[model samples]
Target: MTPPDLSRRALIAAGVAAAAFGPVRSAAGTEPGPIPQDRPVRIAMILYPGMTALDVVGPQALLAGLAPGSLYCVSEAEGPVASDTGLSLVATHAFAACPPDLDVLFVPGGDGTPAQMRDAALLAFLRDRAARATWVTSVCTGSLILGAAGLLRGYRATSHWCVRDAVLPLLGATPVAERVVFDRNRVTGAGISAGLDLALALAARLRGPDYARTAQLVAEYAPEPPFQAGTPAQADPAIVRAADAILAPLVAGATAAARS
Candidate 1:
């Protein structure tokens, strides 16, 4: 029997339908079937004032593609959450409205991390969600927030270089100075730009390396920075000193917050 020829519009509609009800194929040649609608992977990202915009946005760009309609920006109250640089990202869900069980619980680091560390409600939310989350993750200083929530006790984590060694110990977490550190389902990324790498790793874990590689290819994530000064080790002494000066206040506040 011959199949009927379809118009371009019909073909486009079919493609959209396939995307909506597509099977998540694994690299091992698993049979195609629709993902269980009732058990979609739920991702919750915490947003707070003074957070680094890139910390969350970088990871979200990749993670959003992994599961459409699953990623959520959550906060104490749903509204525009302001970042350190005055950029605001809207929180679609409030802490109370977010799902009880999450596949991924993510937080972003920023100058406001110290304040968030001291926020009892936010800490409680993190603690609760992390208790059942498959992955408790953070980018940069977000690890500090997780530690404050008592979620990172005895866990090896990473954070922004400025506070990695200074504050994590105070919160009972072993800090590693790396781009991304994963210790038993707790994944932490160091600094703002590392969020992309961290999300890619999580994507690979959740889906497969093939999916992550395809995402990377789609994003053209090849990096050729104009300068080799992304890290303190690679930067000039004067530049490193300047950067430290800018971060001194945040480091001091986070350290104090960790202790208290």
Candidate 2:
């Protein structure tokens, strides 16, 4: 699907009409004129059962500006794919239909990650596509799936904090605790919300800093969370214990999947 042009120029041009329609203001710009589009980038986001909604959505919302029609949501089959939260996103292309060469190949992490790790067809698809893809990336537990495909071997990567240290070694990946870990062309984001940071970093690599900054400005990506519970270090001991308890099953399942 072609996303609407939400660029700085577009927003400024629509200011009058947008003001009439709602309380929204035109996006503020950090650069003069429009952000230059170097080239059309080809991106493929994998869709599978039980993936996290924000894992893909956050990145895609920002990166879609780099590639409009070329941004493909692909799956084993073409249709609606359900996430862990029961949200459904359409997979516009099937495995066979996705292009061999891609500027970006993105995978999301979620509850179904264990099953995806064990899917031979899915693993094969990733390994095949990653060979030619310029950037291979994952958010949260999606790094486990990439590792299962034998894609992260000898690569420094990161994932959801719960499995970053424990399970990554099983798949031959050295896990780091950073929000976004970049080992050459393989970019892995820590946990879910990190996708936003990863996408902007990638935008700078793909286009330029000015372009990414403009995209960030247009989206107003400045974040101010109300709580300090985002990471284990920041969270209270009680909260960390509860969160660990919740993720225990997933860790076990992913560990088992990686070993097998």
Candidate 3:
């Protein structure tokens, strides 16, 4: 089945697109329990320098609501990391310092992602946790990190259109250009802000479709952007070139960062 596709603009215009919806804590009547309460939903978002805040923080926000107090900001460092936009974000845990058990692991992307893609230490962190994690996910170019770790070797995944070309060949991943893509245990979101789509999908899968629907209602995920085009094939050629021009340096920076 063809998964739904959405652009970052669509997400912003909606403000989730709905207003009256309430917060969703846990999926009612759907709990993957029988495990210890000490674990606390265990979602660790990996942080890096020059990353897009939306790619990491947006989904984390939604997930944060669902699992309050459990959402943690883990990093490969001990201090604040510089974002793609030059914002410094404080990290809670370093890659090597995180706990042994993580229920979910999410990686976000941005101008720093390509550099993160080739980071052996980061890849090892993912690989080590992936062996025991309940779910593994990535946002935007973050999927390339998963591919670099060899987790998406045969899966159809999604990433930001600007970076899909780079991610496609690295790990034999069938890179699908979509808002969100899921292949069993691995879930990925597209563009800078598509993390919400991926998170809602995970919410549905982890709990139930109703949980996702409820979240959609709460997040107001119904409205589409004023821009008629969501997919590149459906967009005007000029728009593509314009966006490409904007990302060229960031892409180059990511490349240089990764190699250095």
lDDT per model, in order? 0.82, 0.85, 0.71
lDDT of 2 by residue, 156-254 (tens): 999999999999999999999999988877899999999999999888887667667878888899999999999999999999999999999889999
Off by over 4 Å in 3: 1-39, 250-260
Worst 10 residues of 3 by lDDT: 14-23
Candidate 1 has what TM-score?
0.86
lDDT of 1 at 152: 88
lDDT of 3: 0.71
TM-score on alpha carbons, each prediction: 0.86, 0.87, 0.78
**Residue 236 alpha-carbon offset, candidate 2, angstroms:** 0.7
TM-score of 3: 0.78
Rank candidates, TM-score, best first: 2, 1, 3
Residue ranges of candidate 1 with Cα displaced over 4 Å: 1-39
Sorting all predicted structures by lDDT, with the top scorer first, yields 2, 1, 3
> Which tens-of-lDDT digit does each residue in 116-226 have in candidate 3?
777889999999987766677898888877887888888888888876766455566887878888776678889876888888878666545654565576567776688
lDDT of 1 by residue, 126-154 (tens): 98887767778999999999999998899
